[model samples]
Target: MTYVDGFVLPVPEGKIDAYRQMAESAGKIWMEHGALQYKECVLEDAKPEMPEDAPETCKITPFGKLAGTKDGETVIFAFIVYKSREHRDEVNKKVMADPRMQEACDENNMPFDPSRMAYGGFKALVDL
Candidate 1:
């Protein structure tokens, strides 16, 4: 079965560009390390929900509107998929040890609030 690591976090208004760039780089590393896919999306049309397993989807939104979302929130969601849990763990370990991981983890420049991030690992039961 495929394994995936999913994440959601609030990205600060000021550092979106830097965070995107960093995420892009990290995504590349994950792919190179054997991730089947890596995806990131910005929350655009979200309404208050009883936070479920994950947001339904993300749509495009004006930068200003995204920045001004209730409580000044902008969600960044991502997922990395791998062939299996063991492969996911192996690649993740390498990703963590890579020097670029430190740069990617630079919270000062990261748009997302690390402390409030929601994340989990999932095993895919079906994919179509």
Candidate 2:
């Protein structure tokens, strides 16, 4: 079983390289702090394909729509996995305390708007 932290956010298309650099740096820090895995993925083909039998309210919304992504922006989905909730807490505590993490969060250096980022912790229901 694994506990994970997930994130979804919008980033301008022109800023994708900058965002990738930031995510790469942050991912390394998370791994160094004992996270089992760290991944960041940008949306490629996000068209929604709803089942005919599904309710109207159940229509699938693409990541871009869900994030209110602008014409020149795209969505990024990211996650960090840990052995368990306790392990996730321990690793995150260290990651947050690291100087590199602080450097990454410096207002002048951040590649994206922190306020627009959606983040949450999840318990893995099925991992195969």
Best by lDDT: 2
Q: Which candidate is the best by TM-score?
A: 2
Candidate 2 positional error at 31, Å: 0.4
Backbone clash pairs for candidate 1 read none
The global C-alpha lDDT for each of the candidates, from Candidate 1 onward, is: 0.78, 0.92
List ranges where model 1 is wrong by over 4 Å: 48-70
Question: Residue by residue across 1-128, what tens digits does model 2's lDDT show?
Answer: 89999999998899999999999999999999999999999999879687789888986769998888888989999999999999999999999999999999998887778788999999999988
Worst-scoring 10-residue span by lDDT in model 1: 59-68
Candidate 1 residue lDDT tens string, 30-74: 988889999988776565444466566743455334334446567
User: What is the Cα-based TM-score of model 1?
Assistant: 0.77
* Candidate no. 2 TM-score: 0.91
State the weakest 10-residue window (summed lDDT) of model 2: 107-116
Angstrom error of the Cα, residue 13, model 1: value is 3.0
Q: What is the TM-score of each candidate against the true structure?
A: 0.77, 0.91
